[model samples]
Target: MSRWLLCLILVLGLTGCQSSAATNPKLPYAAWYLGFLAPNYMEVWLERADISDINGLIFPRAMGGVVAMGQPESLSATARGWPKRIGSGKGRSMTGLDLPYVVSLRWQSMVEPQTYHAAFLIPDWARRKMVESLPADCPVSGRTSDYRKDLTIGLAPGGVVKVWIMGPCLDPIEVLTLQAEIEPKGPYGGKSGGKYRPLSPVVKAYVDKYGVPYGSWWAPIPYTTVGP
Candidate 1:
């Protein structure tokens, strides 16, 4: 079957499969839940450093790769982590480590998959939001969790990528926005469907439920910031 046809099949068969498994409530740190919104089929790999102060947090690349597509958004699996304590006894404090986070993605065009890669740096605003002070009643040895647990990625034609991050204690914050070096490749020599490709079933469903927030078509979404 054609790639588009296979994607359509996944849309029909994988309906209601967007939700990821729930993270444990008692965990004291951020557990990442990844979500993706796109009009085309994509293979995604997430990479992060092994040494992090956020204990138990794992990268999706370690779990192989993620297959994502559709609209509204589809979530893959969850990565759990907790805050690691520093020192000992009354002097113990939470250690928040800053590590590199990277993403490699492949989108299947008409003839082949066009690959793109980008790295995410936790912005200052997000870093501040992650490290709120502990409450007075909390033990002196205990500390607040310092991590954003949710990440969403929006993909458009021509390699436009928009990324957002949030957590239970924070609101959604856009961290990365850029147009990648994606070679031109699509239906009709890339002329017929620059941003007018018909809505796939998954996208149509999202429109039916939430309406289109991007004016008309979703692709070529306006860029808020252009660089890293």
Candidate 2:
């Protein structure tokens, strides 16, 4: 083959390898999205929260493994205002062959007692506690209400993982407290709610095991955006 042609082939081969590596980075855990959520949303929020840099640390929670020193490309895309398809906002669950993952949110208002809203998916023990601690018909709307905070935890073929949201806040201290409440706890200790079973298997297990429908463990980092 001509030298020029051979060089072109080599360059093309290297480019293909790089692209493949980007799509599958040999992550420590099997990462997938559940429900209507998408990684893109978290990417956007992370940038807005000023957590643009994770310091080259990638912790894969589900598989109980670490990814050494590598930053996520999604983080960069989010910083650059890349277009993404978040969801329809109509509320739907993800199904089929993809792995399972959870998303949690905690909204903390600047109000007194530092009212916090938390949500997550954990083993049965933690969920039961959350349910008992939080009011059944907890009001979700108010000027300083912790609404829109939710937890989605469940099993995917790989294992379990949690995603959490904490904030748009004026007080850093309050945000810290809200972040501390979502850590996982022991197994279920209370009665199960038959009426709530159909809501979400992952959530139900949490309630059945811990009396709380979600675990609490979230810490808010800063996020920022660069463009209009």
TM-score of each: 0.38, 0.19
Counting clashing residue pairs in each candidate, in order, gives 0, 42
Top lDDT prediction, candidate number? 1
User: What tens-digit string does per-residue lDDT give for candidate 1 at 1-228?
Assistant: 235634533343344221223123233453335555443332222211121112222233222223354223552211111001101111111223222133434333211234343333345554444344333322453434434445555554435566655444433555666655543443233554543334456544444554423322222223322223
Identify the runs in model 1 with alpha carbons over 4 angstroms from their true place: 1-30, 39-100, 109-115, 131-147, 168-170, 183-228
Write one digit per residue (lDDT tens) for candidate 2, span 1-228. Answer: 235634533443344322212343232223322222222112101100000001111111112111111124333323111122222221222211122221223211111112122332233332222122222232344234222122222111111122322112211111112132311321111122211112234333332343421222122223411111
All models: lDDT? 0.36, 0.22
> For residue 176, what is the lDDT in candidate 2?
14
